[model samples]
Target: MLTPQQPLGSGFGAATTTDEVMTGIDLSGKTAIVTGGYSGLGRETARVLRAAGARVIVPARDLSRAREALAGMDVEIAPMDLLDPTSIDAFAASFLESTPALHILVNSAAIMAVPELTRDARGYEYQFATNHLGHFQLTTRLLPTLRNANGARVVSVSSIGHRYSPVFLDDPHFEHRQYIPLAGYGQSKTANILFAVALDQREKAHGVRAFSLHPGAIADTGLGKYIPLEHRVAAGVIDEQGKPVRDPARQLKTIGQGAATQVWCATSQQLNSLGGVYCENVDVAPVMKEQPEKIDMADAMRLTGVVPYAIDPASADDLWELSERLLNW
Candidate 1:
């Protein structure tokens, strides 16, 4: 049976940090792959997991940069670009051949609202390609190792931004509809939740559970590098100088606070039997009572519950098929 999309009241809240979630959790001998593990919440996630004794591998698009950012950390760094299919395949192939098991997979890498319209080599929108399709390809390829583990979990870092748009099944590449940065980003994030839902349904019997979450609006991370300063300032995420700022109207998260939900989703004993639900601030997010007829960026930035469109089982199943077909899997 599917887990309900409601909070378990795990006694954790928005203020919880990544380190706080790791209290008493021992991950010795576990192996984890955290994409984008060199920066932002990804870096913090890798750090805490390593502190708990898990062997973490960080796949980077730039090995030198990853090495520099990850200096002094005992973790493996490999090359893989989410935009490049050949690289993703090679990385997956190598890991499958050498690694005995993959206890955790955190699809934490993503590109947020790019100001301009961009597409991948296949003419797919850049955001959708990187955030959803790429992870889709990577996770499907890693199924064997995940299943081999005693209890494997795949954590996807979705966002409240998911409420900004539904999947544009008809024209995701902006072939017809106008290209709006937030819209593309929203569709991709929505896809992330649907992907997790469909994946958990398929893999739960094999001891693998999948989850998607909003890591909170962290202001200082490189994830917001592409967002224009004015927009961010208006969004209450930063000051004029790019420093993190807190707005009473909209809660702002520190890096540690932002990384908490994914870590909890990946390691919490409370969710051992739970999967396929979207989470926020360390708890399963409630399903929204009604989806807005139009996209509302300001409303989305503050709200918590996930829209029903994101977790619809039919849509999830259909998306899974579409993704597999797109990737030729």
Candidate 2:
């Protein structure tokens, strides 16, 4: 199994910013696909990437609203619904039709901690299917673009929730007993890290690298708006002031700060020579050996060190196969 490949003290700690980390780097002439890049940390990511000279493509589900939000921003707005496989295919096809090489792909679009068990059109559970499986299919379908890049990187935005549970290989769709939203969601998030590990191992031979990120908790960005209010309070993300405490753990980052790690992962020179680790803020997280008290322990475990589940190549391959079957890819 792959271990925490972190060089001793490799990370620059957790408070790095997109612009600060991206200093002296120029992404000129590169094409980047940032899902949900028009809102929240995604929007901030898009802004930074564009600032560094990469052409940014913000594929969003709600084009009108996304465009309105992204108005006057130097980004290309495209339509993509993660819940719809057909939409995923159409977006891929359309992009490939443009005859371009892809240098960066950030799967930052996700829904967190919802109330119920809902399924997409293909009968796949909503959270798992959209957050992990959709990106899986999208990545696979865009393999050609990824392969053609100079040195492409696929960055998946995973939360600290992977500790909720490892991949439930037995019943990924909750067919066996019950569908707990958080558990199923954890399974999907774990799959995200595994996907990066496995994909990097395979794609490094082709000059393509894959990575996963945890952007920290920023409820105001509408990142976790899908999670009901009660859950937010229960999660301790909200305070009596009806606001995020800015210190998710005594010093939490703002929305811009939350987006920093992801953008850094996507465009930082510090990571130019590395690939296939989970990062938070601007630094790659250290191995989290214990369960966190209130924050996302699962995510910390995955990012900080090599969680056994994420390092298992067989498990990742298994997940890939399961995703293929579910998506009918």
Off by more than 4 A, model 1? 247-249, 294-297
**Model 1 steric clash total:** 0
Clashing pairs in 2: 160-299, 163-298, 247-252, 248-252, 261-281, 286-304, 287-304, 287-305
Q: What is the TM-score of each candidate against the true structure?
A: 0.97, 0.90
Top TM-score: which candidate number? 1
RMSD of each: 1.4, 2.9
> Candidate 2, residues 1-329: lDDT per residue as tens digits?
24355543535545556666667879999999998787888888888888889899988889889889888878899889988889989999999999569999999888766667777777777778888988988888888988999688899988777777788877777778687777877788888988888788778878788888777767688756666676666556776666875663432567777877777777766677578788765667665656554445223322344345654678878877777777665
Q: Write the per-residue lDDT of candidate 1 for residues 1-329, one digit (tens) a residue.
A: 99999999999988888989999999999999999999999999999999999999999999999999999999999999998999999999999999979999999999999889998898888999999999999998999999999799999999988888889787878899988888889999999999999999999999999999998888878777777788877766777787887542254788898899999999999999889999998899899988777755456567779999999999999999888878877
**Worst 10-residue stretch by lDDT in candidate 1?**
242-251
**Residue 60 deviation, candidate 2, in Å?**
1.5
Instruction: Estimate the TM-score for candidate 2.
Output: 0.90
Candidate 2 steric clashes: 8
- In order of listing, the candidates' clash counts read 0, 8
**lDDT, model 1:** 0.91
